[model samples]
Target: MNYDHWGRFLAQKVNEHTGLDILKWKNEKKHTWEALSWPDFYDKVNKTALALLDLGVKSGDNVAIWAENMPQWLVADMAVFSIRAVTVPLYANSPEVQAEYILHETESRIVFVGENEQYTKINAIREKLPSLKQVIVFAEPESPEEPDMSFETFVSAGSFANKAEELEKRRRDASMEDLATIIYTSGTTGVPKGVMLTHANFAETLRTHEILLDMNPGDTSIAFLPMSHIFERGWIYMCLNRGMTIYFNHDPREIQTTLAEVRPTFMCTVPRFWEKVYGAVNENINNGPAIKKKIFNWALKVGDSYYMNHKRVKKEPGVMLKLQHAVANAIVYSKVKKKAGLENAKFFPCAGAAIAPEVATFFHRMGIHLMIGYGLSETTATVTVNRYYDFNLASIGKAMPDLEVKVGENNEIMVKGKTVMKGYYKKPIETAEVFDGEWFKTGDAGYFGEDGNLVMTERIKELYKTATGKYVAPNYIEAKLAMDKYIEQIAVFGDRKKYIIALIAPSVQAIKEYAQKMNIAYDNLEELLSHSGIISFFEDRLQKIQREFARFEQIKKFKLLPYPFTVETGELTSTLKLRRKIIFEKYKELIEGMYVD
Candidate 1:
């Protein structure tokens, strides 16, 4: 392994440990899984790097990748870094205008796309882009498209044999100061800003999270989230640095099936994935026959108690209980684990949003380690994660070894560490505003718990004041409300209006079971959701859940959405946090209707 740069050198060492496949992907057409060994991966990256050099992509140039999680995406990103170029990643769900703005703003000379879907977006704005020189697509073209070449042609066309010396020189010249990536924020408010992170920023994160990084050669993970997002990108890189095989999921909707097939040891994702899993579990238990329901509940109750006690004090259950647990595991809990692909999973990392403590505990109770942490794009990845056997569900965990975190004014979590970014790219004024001298203001409001773990409260900007001057932290309530299995997704609205209200997306499957049990008639989702029976059920549940809150904190009224909030619909970020303004504006009338006389 060569210590050429603060980053790539470490990956070289782990890749040499095992000669197994570095990347594994499914061929949808062939109905088979395909893999790229390290040698094959290196060869591809070499060709891609040469191809970029051939196309006049000089050192330190900005190149963007507009694609999902795929082998080509990783190859292109590596190829860019090999020549000390900055890799800009555009979200696959980004609209044409947003993509156009990012490409134009970054002044990227070259861009790589996945297929026709991305090609169409670029083609629409190609004429408007002056800095963009070429469009290289991965998949074969369906139609006669100008100014485009297939991924194969782009690689084979490069002549790199004679320029080996030049490539080597570029690699040797890379330093910690070199910009590695410029990730744009998933803007829930205004325009998205590009966060410029250096190689050192990334390297520090990998080294700091070294405990979780002890993945063996047999460890595998599914890259299902947007690789463009720093959270997923950093986790995938960690897998590579630990000699773990990576399985790429092209379509995130099939992540469940993919998980079952791969039986991955680790997966880093947002809280929404687990929330859905919890909802499904509840649905199954609620819908099963009376005896089956009783068995499932008994198993879960025993498992939960065993794990909680085990984790807290490292104690073992008594023989009688142990035998019962074994029987329950064989009868019910084993099925639960295998169904969600956690049967072989050693652990999981969930971040990018505040995960409800109940959800985190639910997994821990079932013997799956769900490490819910906190991070932002600016920090490059994870800032804090629950570690060891002590599953502290309330806190995001103690800060990483070298990082320093403090509660600044308004309870903002202030940070000063190596992992913080150089600053937002080309936005000096905004960057300066976010920092109080050396400490970067995280904008998240929280205080350190008595146990010294960081308890993330909510986004400071999301703390709203009502017309009557009663302040409410929506995320605090939202996090608690998300724990209910019947609630799929919810947006707690009532900023300057009156008392609290909510925009709810109920768990359709769970609601279906409820309807069946209660003998409520419904044909479609719209009918089920509109029925008075289910509405009253949710209303009663909401009241009970918010019983601990102040009078003003309780949700007064709510609107039930027939569909779930998604990134494509501009209601959720890639990590599943609510896009507040978009949801508010989109459903402005519904919110107003709730307050009508």
Candidate 2:
């Protein structure tokens, strides 16, 4: 816990601290888990560092990790930092082109991946990457050579007595000013930009985050969120700093199942994950028997009344309300929470994007704290977070200690703090453009509430003025509509147009269920979705959800997409956020058709 001028925090913690527990992960067969004790983890890091030295990697070099959240990812990250080499993380879902651009841009010397798919992707382009000396895969490689090598072999290649002494010397030589990592932003618009974060940037954020949230000694967490993201990466580091047990979830699709097993104290996530959980819970309720449905609804009503009285109403729940809640929890919410993998969760930080107000209230009613915080990758994962004691779900909460926030021109949120990135990697022109004096332009627009809590708002760049010069924030509309059980993803389109319209991607599972009930026949998802009855159903659902929004914000028309936006299709970023620019352009015809008649 030393906050001296500059030092290797991870190494210091491992060496100085005793009784550190193991990091757990499922073995290759997925039947059971393997664990790494602190001493074992420290040894892996040392070996990895020495391996890098064998690869001719030097201080200040960029090394990339293209994998999911695993013990090796953490080991490689700490190893790279131990030698003062920069760590660049690539999204596991990133295509070859995107991965190639970052690897080439950073001039990465060594790259590590988790599995075969990533290895194949990198191997396909290895010829183009002249500077990439070693491509290390977590598992055993088919053949160990200059281009492709197994991680175990890479570690073994570094087994030398001299390397350990050299590592110690390099640790002492490490400076806070040295570049620690290049975290790529989730490019929702154009190409992804690498944000340069220093050891000081991480140290400052870690120091502040430790104060904002309290994690107990034996608290555990499952990291299903993509580790390539700054949000997950920072959360992982924060857990490490707290001596919390970490569970590595190889597949995000299995989060619910894994959650049931891990029963973690907390998990960090995006609003979309909560949306799915809410939808699934509701779907089960809807499909339940009459008696069960009655109990579920009644339980929710009682829970909401009790929760609101305690949370927003600032009133103690009467004895009757408390009793009702206790019965409700025993029969419904508690069972649902336990099955959903959030039973032990104290609070999970929900950020990366805006959450629907209805969904936020839903979790709160269920006695789950979806702490709707806010931060960009450039801010080392968080600038503002909703604290446990004082928070409004509607707001992104107050800024962290030592952070300065102000509203500048156009109501754009400006921030200045130690957690802010040094600059965009090797892009001074772009870096200078984002700064206004000392404050880093957040590119988001919002106003402080009367209580001084920062209200989360739409990005300034995304605010579109219609043909009548009446500006509308598409994200606000999109968020509201996305809360519907039938809706999977939504994009509002009224920019320079007469009336607002939307491109909707209805939930495939929900649609399938509806089709079966209505006796609608179709061969494929597209055909099923395009049925007249299905269209009518969505029209009704859309109108109902739109009632929550202002008249102008309501969607007059919409086009239902047969398929959801995906990262592989270039319609979404690695973080699962819509690529608005790509989506708008790709669906240009469908959008124009909505306005035609």
Worst 10 residues of 1 by lDDT: 1-10
Candidate 2 Cα misplacement greater than 4 A, ranges = 4-7, 15-17, 28-30, 143-147, 287-294, 311-321
Per-prediction TM-score to the true structure, in the order listed: 0.93, 0.95
353-414: candidate 1 lDDT, tens digit per residue? 77877777777767888877888898887878788656578889888879998999999999
**Candidate 1, which segments miss by more than 4 Å at Cα?**
1-11, 289-291, 316-321, 483-486, 507-531, 563-569
**Residue 513 in candidate 2 has what lDDT?**
86
Tens-digit per-residue lDDT, 338-432, candidate 2: 88877898888888788877788888888898777889888887888777655677889899988999988989999998988888987898899
On the 0 to 100 scale, the lDDT of residue 290 in model 2 is 89
- Count of backbone clashes, every candidate in sequence: 0, 0
Cα miss at 95, model 1 (Å)? 0.7
Among these predictions, the greatest lDDT belongs to 1
